[model samples]
Target: MSATICAFILTFSTLCGSRVVSGVLSAPTNVSLTSYNMNLVLRWGPPEGATQDLVYTTEYKTSVTNYNVGCVDIITLECDFTSLSVSMHPPIIEYGTYTGRVRAQLGSASSAWVESEQIILDRDTIIGSPRVSLLSNGAAIYVSIVDPVFVISTLRNTYAFATYSITYWNGSQKEKARHINNTQQNHVILKDLEPWTEYCVQVQINVDRNPNPGQLSETVCESTTSVEEAPWVPLMVTIFFVALAVTLVAVTVVYRKSISHFLCPKDALPQHFKENLLKPPNSTIYLDSHPPVEKWHEVQIIADTRTVEEEGPSGGSKDCLQRTA
Candidate 1:
């Protein structure tokens, strides 16, 4: 009984010692890969009941390549592998399928490596929304597009066959939106539009290999310029004519008598006098006709010398008096 008890104690001690010697930090959990706009990130959850300060190291691998060390001694739970570079290893390729692994470390102790789900760089990545701007021309709209920026490369560089899909509509009528697809130009002009009309535009990027298109951009609105004449032109002309007619009516009402006097003078004879003058006389005076044919008769001249001498100058009066005598 004594030997058996000692053996049992030894066995218990050995088991406990082995457990304490082999203990290590807990590994990260729920390791996963997420991508956006051609940017790749590896993320994981912290170990349960973890109280000690812990650091993490990540590794990534492709099907045809060996595992390569990624972020080392990182305290954060996430790693950005989009532009991460490893020693003696090439960068992540667009067509490559990748897997990631992360483990927790505390000094010399380390947990088991946890692997993440596989992800296709080109297929699984989401494309972000593009930016749109608009300008107005005469009866036309100029659409300017800016492609979505990416962590690895530009939208056009990554997707070589990419195209811009444009949609525009009159601001007043959204149901009549028009679409222009597969346009390669970033600056596009929409013509044959109504003059001085407000238009709203939206832009999206489309890739041939991608089944889903990019997110739609924010709607931008602008107004098209007038083609021939401004809308206010006709309104101003109508107003001018109305004002002119009003002025003319006011003048005619205020100065009617003066205008009538100017057109017909007041110096003309009376209506009765005009009628009498126009009428022929009934008979002429017979005595006046005979007196015009009478002969002239000589009359004797008598000089008044006394009155002339009193009224005239002295010498001339005397000469006149002597001649008269």
Candidate 2:
């Protein structure tokens, strides 16, 4: 989105042109306020030539009161009051309505103070402008919030809060702008748009607490989707399904054996082994026979003896004895 901010400058003049006389100088003219980096600046144009040295002072007020501040006394054509100090009951540098004035000064002589109308600064007013997007491939426009809300409860800014307002119009002549409001939901999609037609849209923060609305986003304009490609949708859809079916068939043809194993497998072992596995009688296999017993026999032995006797030496022979076995 493209955007431009106006730098407002206000000036006052006591003399018509560069006419020179030995007296107080003329006030500035064509004062305009411009938006810059979320701040306001004042700029103006002055007469062509100058002879005497001049100084400047400025004042601002949220309400009617004495507001005095130092404006750059240099020969510059503009002043930035956003950072300027002031002597006032309540300062205008906040988020509220303000009115300001400026005057030219010499050593002793001074020009009349020229005052401005009500100048409102909610420098914190609108968040960065909302963003516009084209959708339906260009059939519709989308509007939504792009930044957080800028709220200054210090000033009790009581306007439409928590809502977004969208305005749209056709590019053709005599078309009245249409609007829609949404609560909290910061986005909206416009449908049933005329194909190939141009449209404009803008969005703003809606404040319900007061009549004043939040600032508007930058305006966006775009052409709707074209109708020339309407017939291609169904043709593309048919091609998609046909391609999908062909891919599935090719995969199945290449991996048929793996698919069969996964879906239907056969038994790998005999059925009898499974049946007799837990039967105790059939659980063991013996390989050896029984052993024979041994018998024993007993025997006895007999002995016989015979005896003989002999006499003394002086006597005749005595009896002799002998033993036999």
Candidate 3:
């Protein structure tokens, strides 16, 4: 009977040790926070030996005194928390520090708490809508902070401090134009810009000097002025004037030559001589005379005959005979 009891005890001890070994192997490990923005995310490796399904439970603690202010159950290796209201309620706290841990469970067995590194949960003050306007010689951008309603009695000034910067893209590259403290006036002049070129500008603001700054505001795009001139019109006017002057000179020369040809002739002579030279002369001749007497006849006879011809017929016959000879 003693030998049988020893065998049964040995068998029971072996079974219990095997079960404990399996449970230890099944616990998750290497649990840590992967990334965080406003919320927290936890990631861990899968459990080891046990085949049965396992679940993970996460808990957050704002203070070391209270370790279980919030809890969540997750079946997968990853877990996400959209909202963390742990510090807001009953146990009032300051602006920054918070801690959290995660655990794995299977059936009746549970693993140890895998605590995370301490993280800060500070309140972020957002810069309000920025004012943009065009100035006389440049552009101006104004940034303001949204006033928080809850006032802290310890601090004298309630206004949150903010820093701002203005940047402009000059087609090929970007340049930092100005830096403003506490959201003051930011003005930048667009000098020496190429005509008809495009420019892009951006304004950035950071509150509480957070290293990872907020989103950049929308870009403002504008084009420069044109540079072409009205030279063609002037050129056309000059050409027209030159052509008009040349035409007037040609007309004047032609008129002068025509007037000189008409008023003054190359050959100079008297008007009467010119007219007689131009007229045609007559060819016929006219004469009134008596017939010439013969040489032998005396002068008295010739004269008597001439007188008789004038008075009678005998004288006319004699004058006819003398004219025949």
lDDT of each: 0.82, 0.57, 0.52
What is candidate 3's lDDT per residue for 1-325, written digit by digit as tens? 9999888876755665323433442346677653232444566775544344667787656645566534455687766543445355333233445566777776667777777776553343233334343212123222222222222211113224645565555545555343333443444454555566556666665556345454565666665556433434656999999999998888778787776767885667889998998776653332324554557754553433345435435545655666877
Q: If candidate 1 were superposed on the true structure by all CA atoms, what would the RMSD be?
A: 26.9
TM-score of 2: 0.43
In candidate 1, what are the lDDT values of residues 1-325, reduced to their tens digit?
9999888876755654322234776678889987888877899998764544788999888888878888899999999886675455558767778999999887787888999999888778878888898867679887889988887767777789999889999998999999999999998989899988899999988887667778899999999887644545666999999999999999999999988899986878899999999886676654345555568999999976566435445546665666877
Global Cα RMSD, each model: 26.9, 25.6, 30.5
- Global lDDT for candidate 3? 0.52
- Whichever of 2 and 3 has more TM-score, that candidate is 2
| Steric clashes per prediction | 0, 36, 0
TM-score of each: 0.58, 0.43, 0.42
Off by over 4 Å in 2: 1-22, 29-55, 62-65, 85-97, 106-109, 118-129, 137-141, 147-164, 169-178, 181-184, 194-200, 204-325
Sort order, lDDT high to low? 1, 2, 3
**How close to the true structure is residue 74 of candidate 3, measured as C-alpha lDDT?**
62
Model 1 bad stretches (over 4 Å): 1-22, 86-88, 172-176, 228-325
Which pairs clash in the backbone of model 3?
Answer: none
